[model samples]
Target: MSLQYVQGASLFTHINEVPKQYAYLTQNISTDVIIIGGGVTGSILGYYFSRQNIDCVLLEKSRIAFGSTSITTTLLQYELDSSLRDLEQYTPLENSLKAYKLGLKALDEIDAFINEQGNNCDYEKKDTLLYTSKKEEIAEVEEEYNLRKTHGFSAEFLTASSNPFSFDLKAGLYAMDGGAQLDPYKYTHQLLDVSSQKGLQVFENTEVVKVNYLDHGVEVETTYGYKVKGKIIIVATGYNTQLFTKRNFGVKTTTFNIATKPVTSFGGWPGRVLIRDNSSTYHYFRTTADNRILAGGEDISFVPGIFNEDAALEKYELLEARIKTMFPLIKDIEAEYKYCGAFASTQDNLGFLGKDPKNDKLWYCLGYGANGILFAILGGMMLSKLYLGTFDENLKLFKLDRFDG
Candidate 1:
């Protein structure tokens, strides 16, 4: 039975009327690296490997970026889903800071790649506003602000009086130049397009059905009975790794989002910064290049089965109500598109990005947090180095065995 990963009408403004046709694997092939999944993570791995003259083959079960990548809100924030203070409970403060710094570096790397490729992906550097809706949470927000400032990050504390939004901010941290937004679907296709020219082979509708580990390497058999032999296999398939591993690496949830039609004015939105609250399941929002408000985050526990139309409509209604509440002045903000998809979150809010402890050649890049895209960027870089026999100290923070029983 096929699973529906995404549902409802999702707008594709960033993507043009490009051809959807791609080659299907029908013959056996060999490569230095094999990447499963054609989303942003796999595309990044393909880009880095192909640029370094490594023979990489990427196989996707469906069309490129047709999975979670298409429905992603694309709010790139250096802040983890777990706050820095909260993350300290599971790991060392120094390690948490290292992950935060790595997120910042990933933002820089993404900007550099866009500049180098000159792709029009609606990439924009924006500030992030990590605020609390309740007045009682002001102290916690202040703690986060002070910690970031002490670590040399450019953070400013804001109170209800100083906050620029229409609503009462109570307290917030203005993370300057620490976030970005982009079109993940376009970015993935563009990266694959360029990499294909540099000897990177990509095949859509090629689903890997079985794996045969060899003494020297590994062989992956596709659904079409085509074999792919590679020195290493990177599973960038997001939360769909049940076929390969039995471990529950992350907790799965279904999140909803809605995109509004382009508005005429900002209506006191304040620099159009990316905004997220301090709620257990926070609402995140940002403006598109065309001035549309894209907000999401009414997450519910994941239920395995077909899409529930009634549940989806309820989530969309809640999301729309949230938009109206947040920006009261904006009138007639009709939701042009609404979508819901599966999202995964880890216990420590850090991604799992390294080799499987039981298997030597099987690597994983499961980025399970709000900083997933940033973590994917870091994963591509680190995993490439690991494959080349280089050791990175940061890899220890995301090892699969970090939470061993």
Candidate 2:
């Protein structure tokens, strides 16, 4: 089983009001696909595969949506954690542009899901702002804005004298309709619930103790000693995968978040736009469905933060202070929920997807950065098609062995 990503009761769980439950694996099962992890990524995979009439089983070690999904800020932005100029040093500019476009595609895919399945996840499209409070960084932000605008992307460059936001901003790139916000915990359950109705067997508290990769298929033994046979196994177990592969995937960091009580007044924050300061610390903020301001991003290196209380509390205080300083117009900024969890990120600010380079029977849908949700959406659409004799060339962008030296 994976280690807990979150420590206390998260805001997402309390907002759920009535929680959904799944049955434990009481008997052995056989299916075409066995998804390991019932978080948002695995739930999305199940939703895609189940719709294809593929017999799939989703296994969660503990309660569904209570893992890393519950602790996420759920600020879905198409932009990566790094700027395109910085990302170009690792990959070509065209490739970075393709990633940007893929993010938009993923956003549209989520929109379709909400349109068809009905929006019970409090999903909303929001404009994303990545700005700089320092005068020295104005050129860097402007360059990024110019690149997007040159590539025909819908972006507007905001200056200190111009934007509508009351926060400190010398320069900012406003990505119009390229970002979103949602209740990730609710979204995971909703996807799994919908997928379960279409032959997707879901089991909670059913941990996989061992995985045996056979010549044609894979078999996993659960903690209850029940075996599940499947043609393929997809690993979406957040950041805990010591048993899956030997190669380290990404660098782990403990990120903090604080959610304030709902504010009835709009204040100077017009339209509740999503905002992120592109400083060294990479802080971000968004408005929740209930009008509460949710902000995060004092990132420190480590897989878990619960081991150190003093450090975590320090981060929470910093975030609380930072939010109040930035949006002084917003009233009653008391923190109703404060938490931190593990966040995995690559140097290129991208995630790993597609089949294992060494093992064809195993696949990875691990979205390891700020754009995890978008990457997983693309993974579900591409990987699902791959199982049905179709291959998406875009999968080449997120191959598992891209960083191998």
Candidate 3:
């Protein structure tokens, strides 16, 4: 019945349809930290803090990982599809480089955690391909290639390959060391389990309705009329950020994805790395260990919470049509499920990470373009350090006030 509140179907949902730990909130409680969303970002924050012997509470309005986390194509690459050159323009070169380095570190930490926990989340290293559709773009790719090279980040510039898509390429970059793929939901749930095991409290079906900042702490009121107080409050609610910050911060983009039956024997897929072309409205894909080809990214936009059911169905039909058009090798592909969630994008297409502008104890981590998973991990590390008064020089570059004029 709780699944009815979930808008989309994902592989993670199929695996963990029922909650292994089901405890509803009935009374108010106090904690050192309260994480407002139970997606990848919030879960990671909870896990990290709990490991440090910090008392943390995680609240989800709906079910965990039922939101944008489930909708991800699950590519864990440090090389952003958004041009690294463009990223350097909005933020300092050092900050951009730090973000990239932090992304790789986060992916490595996530893989290590999965292995230690022994959670079968289909984690693997994959090479990410970023090719161009126009010949002129080759020079731009080269510039990025050299830029990354200067920083000691590994990226290979390729003009030709016997890859599946035979589209003419001006140039492309493949980062074999930085890219990865995994089941988004399985990873989120694993973090949840680990956090809980470390004494982190989690309340499902609990939604925060209002937040009041106190002189010494913050008070949060939930839809179920339960109130919680915490020394620091972190909002990781993604598109639902308006609930915490009254001012709207970014554009809400709509992206579609589809998964096919397992292609267990596809020779072209090696550990099922991520593949993407430099189309204006581009598509990126990867294969799951189960052999399903997961493709996504016909990026569009719609007003949040008002997305038309009919329009969403039509969008999915178009995605399925595109998947069938692009990869014809698999004959058993089908669009098993589809839904749309909003991706918060700032003017610079970078995340807004750090403490709230008006409140020092209130923190926010969002607007990560489309690649929120890595940012979530980085955010957890940064926020955890801030709360614990332990500082990492690498994370200092992502402080929230970085964007303030």
Candidate 4:
């Protein structure tokens, strides 16, 4: 079954022009590695593999970064969807700490990649605020704060009085340089552009329909009747993984977002920090380089064929109302763009990264969380090392069989 990706106008696509397109696969090709998706994750994989002197071929059914990547809010945070205190219940504390630390490293990796390419994708470093609206949840927020402090992270606990924003913050944790934001659509193209110059072959409008596992390698058949032979195959498809496995790896949801026109003042939003509440289904807001406010997070359980015009309008209205309620000072704020798309979250809220246990030559790097971009960075680095015969202990936490009890 197919899934609906994006349903409305995305602000990122409106601001950025489509990058150069690649030809579809029309003949049999061979490579060391074949990436199945050409969104941000696949582009990242192509970048990492090509840099390591691997012959990499990336295939996309549609234009690059035109799917869920275009609709992404591009909030890069080290924090996962599940809090550190909560995640420790599923795995060891050390593993949870490693996941958190990996996030920081991923942020640095992205920064380095952007600098190395000299591509301006509106990348910027910013602090993050995880706050709670209800006074009763103050203790839980403090517990999360203490966990971070114990791990040697630079975090501060703030109350309603110390909070910089005008909104009600019963308690909050301010993480220093713990998050960042960028233009995902542009970043994907920039990375592919750099990798293409280094012998990476990217094919757009090329959909892999079937895979035949050979004794020495694998052959992937495209819908266009072409074949791609690779020693290893990497599935970087975001929420679409039914083609690779029958296991239910995670749950899918529809997330809504709204972007406002550029405002002249920051008002009480100090330093324009990335803000997310402590609610179960939290709302997150951040500022764009062009001074527009982007607020997202009215997530609901996924239902087939649920992304229609009526659904988009309803979600957009709710998102617009949320922005007005949180920051009433921004008078005459009009939503210039509104969009919604599918996102996935794992059982433990950690990404699935590593080779399929049943198929060693087949690797999966499905990053299912709010910090998906960060996870993608880690997946690219670790997977590259894995192919070079270097195994990381942390991969145990993200292995495909981790959920098989």
Q: Report the C-alpha lDDT of model 3 over 1-405, residue by residue, as the tens digit.
A: 122323566655674455455465789999999988888878888888898889999988887887777776677777554677776667667666766787788878887887789855778877777777577787887788898889998877887554455345567777776688888777887888888999999887898888888989999998889899999898888767767767666666677666765654554344455778667667777787777777777667755445567766777787778666655555667866565555556544557678876788888877367567888787877778778787667555556666567
lDDT, candidates in the order shown:
0.86, 0.88, 0.73, 0.87
Could you list the CA RMSD of all candidates, in the order they appear? 1.6, 1.3, 2.9, 1.5
lDDT tens readout by residue for model 1, 10-56: 65533344434579999999998999988888989898888878899
For candidate 3, the lDDT comes to 0.73
- How close is every model to the real structure, measured as TM-score? 0.97, 0.97, 0.90, 0.97
Q: How many residue pairs clash in each candidate at the backbone level?
A: 0, 0, 3, 0
Q: Tens-digit lDDT track for model 2 on 42-94?
A: 99999999989999999999888778888888888888889999998888888
Question: Model 3, stretches more than 4 Å misplaced?
Answer: 1-8, 161-170, 308-314
Pairwise TM-score winner, candidates 1 and 3: 1
Best by TM-score: 2
Worst 10 residues of 1 by lDDT: 12-21
Better of 2 and 4 by TM-score: 2
